[model samples]
Target: MLPPRLNDGGRTDLDLATLRRATFGLKLGAGVTLISLAIVEKLANPEMARAMLEQEPLLNLLAPFGVSADAFAVVAGSVELLLGLLVISGALPQVVAILTAVPFTATLALFGATEFLGHLPLYGVLLSFLVLGSLEETSHSLSGLRRRAGVPTH
Candidate 1:
């Protein structure tokens, strides 16, 4: 059974546009926080960042191909940074969200139930963004970064 708050107050006069805008803002905040933490972990603590990749299953798989732990950390950090910018700007949000969830999902498999439980809310946010699709207005995102960059909003 869904929570009572999940319903639209059982009202027919709900403003869906406002609801969507609010959700988008929420997603933006969540994405920014997640990315900021990742950048901090990557930039502030190189040893710990490399150690995390070393502990993941991906390292075992990629090690055979000569991908070192440090290399993996650098690559992962770069991808996260790029995806973080796209997500914050609301550019290709669905794609960005899916990409964002890949590492979280991997962590679930690598670390088991505890990690899964911890990241469940983040996974939910990513899934929500995927289902909600892209935002209609790009101007409100990143102070019109897309427009300023000559990127097509559509």
Candidate 2:
């Protein structure tokens, strides 16, 4: 059940263009926050960091990225957090979301591809799909940013 707002801006009509920006923006923020937090914990304490990354499937794939488990956790986490906040607060969410996601998506997809090529398994593919599918959230945030930036909606 969806919660109704009392303000009453009757029959919500969502513009597809606006929806795309909003979705993209939110996804970027969430992803960045998640990654950044993980990296922070790993950096603060090596042992605890090791233990944390051990549970994430990404640990096994870290070697190809040239970052050690501890380093990978810390780096990935910090980067994600920073990126997430930027996406959420950027002045041009629509443009930023599209710009950032392109590289972000490529990095993940490349890693996934490397995993596949290295004979890892199906997990990489699944992770890639998950990462790619979340772009809609990025779009949402981007839409808000776009409106805030005075970008015209279709």
Give the candidate number with the greatest TM-score: 1
> How many pairs of residues in model 2 come into backbone collision?
28
Q: What lDDT does candidate 1 reach at residue 39?
A: 76
| lDDT of each residue in 7-84, candidate 1, tens digit only | 678544324455545556765777687678667877556788777766664644467788877666667777777766
Model 2 lDDT on a 0 to 1 scale: 0.50
With candidate 2 superimposed using the best TM-score fit, by how many Å does residue 108's alpha carbon deviate from the native? 13
Candidate 2 structure quality by residue, lDDT tens digits, 20-124: 554454445455554455555655566776785576545435678676786766665565556556544544444544544543454455467664454332233
Candidates' C-alpha lDDT: 0.65, 0.50
Worst 10 residues of 2 by lDDT: 120-129
RMSD of 2: 9.6
Point out where model 2 deviates above 4 Å.
Answer: 1-36, 55-60, 90-154
lDDT value, residue 8 of candidate 2:
75
How many pairs collide in each candidate, listed in order?
0, 28
